[model samples]
Target chain A: MIELLLTPLHYEYMIKAIVVSGVIGGVCGLLSCFVTLKGWSLMGDALSHAIVPGVAVAYLVGLPFALGAFASGLLAAVVMGVVKSKTRIREDAVIGIVFTTFFAAGVLMISLFPSNISLKTIVLGNILGIADSDIIQMLAISAVALLVLVLKWKDLLLFAFDPNQAQSIGLNTTRLNLMLLILLAATAVAALQAVGAVLVIAMLVTPGATAYQLTDRFGRMMLLACGMGIVTSMLGAYISYFLNGSTGGCIVCLQTLVFLMAFFFAPKYGIVAARRKARRTTDALLISGDAHPVPALRGL
Target chain B: MSHGSTKLNKNDISSEIDLHVNEVTVAYNNGHVALFDTTFDLGAGTICALVGVNGSGKSTLFKTIMGFLTPTRGSVTIGGKPVQVAQKQNMVAYIPQAEDVDWAFPVSVMDVVLMGRYGYMNFLRIPRATDLEIAIESLRRVNMLDYKERQIGELSGGQKKRVFLARALAQRGRIVLLDEPFSGVDVQTEAAIIELLRELRADEHLILVSTHDLGLVPSFCDQVVIINRTVLAAGPTHDTFTQENLARAFGGTLRDLRIDHTDAPDGTSNEFRVLSDDEEPLIFGHDGRLVDHWHPGIDEEESK
Candidate 1:
């Protein structure tokens, strides 16, 4: 077991994959806290998928993939915003409509070009073969996104909790929301380097949600989530060396597993713990002669 | 139709105003006139009720005052400055509706209150020691100091209202606008909030509370501004909060009940009138003096 745990560090490709995965994971994790809190989880999914056409176009034009992906990600976000605001269609439905359309256009664009890159690789990225340039770009995007999130978290929390109050206090809620969107775009671009478009949403959603179930402080929730992301992505990447499997899938599966543990076992907010608490309350009430089999508890 | 129509010159108000909505007309992007030729001026040490029926431009007025909406024809000034400038100077505070806040968001009661000091904080919003002290004092004022570390989501509806009130208090703004503070609160909580507002009034803070609880208006508020797309009346509460003006403002929404006129043993005539807009009913004795509140569960005269 020790040898297996220590073996991945010997391989240069494995070390690089682990480091890149951990960095992107931490970035996505922190951003996911805001995404989940702002109820923008679907927006994360949308931006990730919507960048496919940009990547395809970049491949076609021989331009850098990060630039194209970032631009398309932002464009998709704007399109989603416009559609949701202009029409009576619900926001979730609008996100679905825009992202799928963009993704289909990307697939069509890719099909028109020579098959230098496999569609599978774009959709389910090969982190094992990430180029040195891609790693540098991903790390740069991660660092900048991390810095912005750290600097503006307080205002962003205010925006997420009560936008009306934020606006009332002279903070421009519209601009804050736009900043979050731009950060989300950057995160999607950074995450795409490791997890590809399809699995990026899990990386951007699960850590925050799992951390949320475990804590009641937004600051602590972000820290826990970032830590969860880094640990899980690193472990998944390392374990994938032995499993000979998809790194992104392994990372997501590990996150889902952590989420399940928190769901049932979190001290205060978990389902199992809550049920236990309820039973104890009922028992206490019954013993204390305060229980009544009438009114609210009559059916029971 | 009119009582103490205290419209003042723009220049006179610009200096002395705690809040001045001078002939403000707000139109929607589609050119629908939401608020038409509305005007009201208030100075310090006032707790005024902003009374209106739904869609009667109450929210539009609030939006304009908070600088969320631009008025087509008029301006809102606070502390001798424009709404935007006043807000930038941290002179405006708002307590939002319950629906406007995500109660389940992970934040402590103290965090919500400290948000009020954001205007004074640096760009990173690291709460200074003074900010923390003010927040603690605000929480103490609202009787929520013990719950400062508790998650805001863990609070009851009344507790939630108090937390926001504490937040407004911490803001230390001269002009405070509260949107439906009493809508979901219990009577005890309502009384407590009003008591706090009275203290704020004594401290010379100008407060505007938009509420549907008409019955409590005369009992607590010092002034009233009744509106229906325009200011129908604005002045001292007793003169402006009459049923006639409310009937016009509410437009058939108010229901009334009157006891038959009776001659007392002392030879003075006695009458009881109840006017309600389907909320807490207001009972008035002879000469429009607000009397004991009308409660469905209590037959007060018989009980007496």
Candidate 2:
């Protein structure tokens, strides 16, 4: 078993791939907690896809791809916010409109420029082909983003829970909101190098949602999500090595598997556990000759 | 419709003003007025009730006081300072409606209450021992210290209200604003909140509560402010919360009820029956005094 695990370490490219994918998973997992709590899952999907045009444009203009991705992602977020607040359009509709437009623009740019950048790689990521500089860039962005999220998580939690109360306590909720959006864009840019645009949403949402089913506390939810993220990324990377398949695809599939496990097996909130609890309560009531047959419990 | 038709009773009001709304006017983005030229003053050691019908701008006034909405023409001040400055100084706290929060968010009851100290703590500094002690004391005051570790989502409606009340209490602010604190609460929880408000008033805290429960006003509040789109009357509850003021604030519905009462058989008993469109009629009796007592959902089945 040890030799099998160490087999991948023999290749320099494999080791680099593992490190880059792991870093992406961890940062995205940490952010997933906030996204899940705030019901910003669609926002994450929107921002990830919206950065495609920026990546294409940056490659065209000879600028750093991360910078362009961050700019375009931020612009998309701002536009979405304005549209939701200034008009009567619902948030989901606004997100859908903004992201699809940006994504279409990106596809058009790629076809127009006809560069070495492949549409498949941009849509589905190329973890094994990441250069040393790309690894370094990913590490820098992930470190800064994770550090800030760890340090100011409480304030962010309070803001997400209740913005009006946070403002009443003298916290600048608007600034906090803008800061969160910026971090989101940056995280999307960082993850873009690993999972590309389309599959990044899975990385940004699944870990926190799975953790949410397993824990009732925010701090514990974050820790569990980070753990799940790292584990899935490493396992997915190893499995993909053997199958000769997409690492991002394997990672997202593994995350879904973990979520399914939690759905049925989590002690407090899982379907199976809830059924067991109901049975036990009913048995106790029957033994005591006090089973009144509650109408609500009948359905459960 | 006359401004200042009801005068402030100096003998009943304290000289020190804890909260002042000076001719505040709030308008929505579409140039529609929500609250027009409203003014009121509240002092320490008093609990004030903001009474108005639906769409009468009660929430707009509270939001303006909390600095969430900027007044178009006037200002809100606390302790002779602007609302923002007072908020920064930790002199004002607001307890929002329960429905405004995302209850499913993962947070402990203790964490929610501890958020009150965020105004006093320095940037990024965790709560100290003193902060925890104050939070615990606040919880104890609301009889919710035992459930401090429970998730907020698991709490009942009354428990949620207590948790929010504890949060406001933990702030130690001299002025606290509550928006519809008793809307969904049970009778026992309402009584508990009333008791807590009395205790806060004894500690010289000024409380402004917006409630649709008009029955609680005479018993629990010392002052009342009636507003339609503007301040109809603002003074001591016993002096300003008259039938005429209520009629003006509530519009023709109240006038119709008064007329229905005059046509009743027991007209000399000073009883008024308010018949809602959907619900049963509620009968209120005034025994030759300003104190009007009525029961909600009482004799409802019989009336039906």
lDDT scores for all predictions? 0.86, 0.83
Which of the numbered candidates is closest to the native, going by highest DockQ? 1
Residue pairs with colliding backbones in model 1 are none
TM-score of each: 0.90, 0.89
- What is the C-alpha lDDT profile of model 1 across A1-300, one tens digit per residue? 887679889999999999999999998999889888888888889999999889888877877788989889988988988998799999889999999999998888888885455577678888899888878888998999999999999999898888877887799988998999988888888888687789999999999999999988999999999999999999999889889999999999999999999999999999999999999978877786646646587435
User: B150-174 in candidate 2: lDDT tens per residue?
Assistant: 9998988999999999998888777
Question: What C-alpha lDDT does candidate 2 achieve relative to the native structure?
Answer: 0.83
Model 1 chain B scores worst on lDDT over the 10 consecutive residues at B1-10
- Model 1 lDDT per residue over B1-304, tens place: 1111111122224434468889899999777999999988898889999999899999999999999999999888887688887787667889999888888888999989999888778889998777888899999999999999999889888999999999998887778899999878898999999999999888777899999989899888999999999999999998999867887887667666665445456756666666666754556766788876653422323110
> Local error of candidate 2 at A146, Å?
1.2
> DockQ of every model listed?
0.74, 0.70
Query: Interface RMSD (Å), each candidate?
Result: 0.9, 1.3
Per-residue alpha-carbon lDDT of model 2 for A1-300, expressed as tens digits?
988868888899888888778887988898899898888889889999999999899888877778888889988887888988888998899999999999999989998887767788789898888767767877888999988998888888889888887888788998888878878888888888677799898888999999999998988999999888888987887778878899889999999999999999999999999999999998987786645577566434
Give the least accurate 10-residue stretch of model 2 chain A, judged by summed lDDT: A290-299
Clashing pairs in 2: none
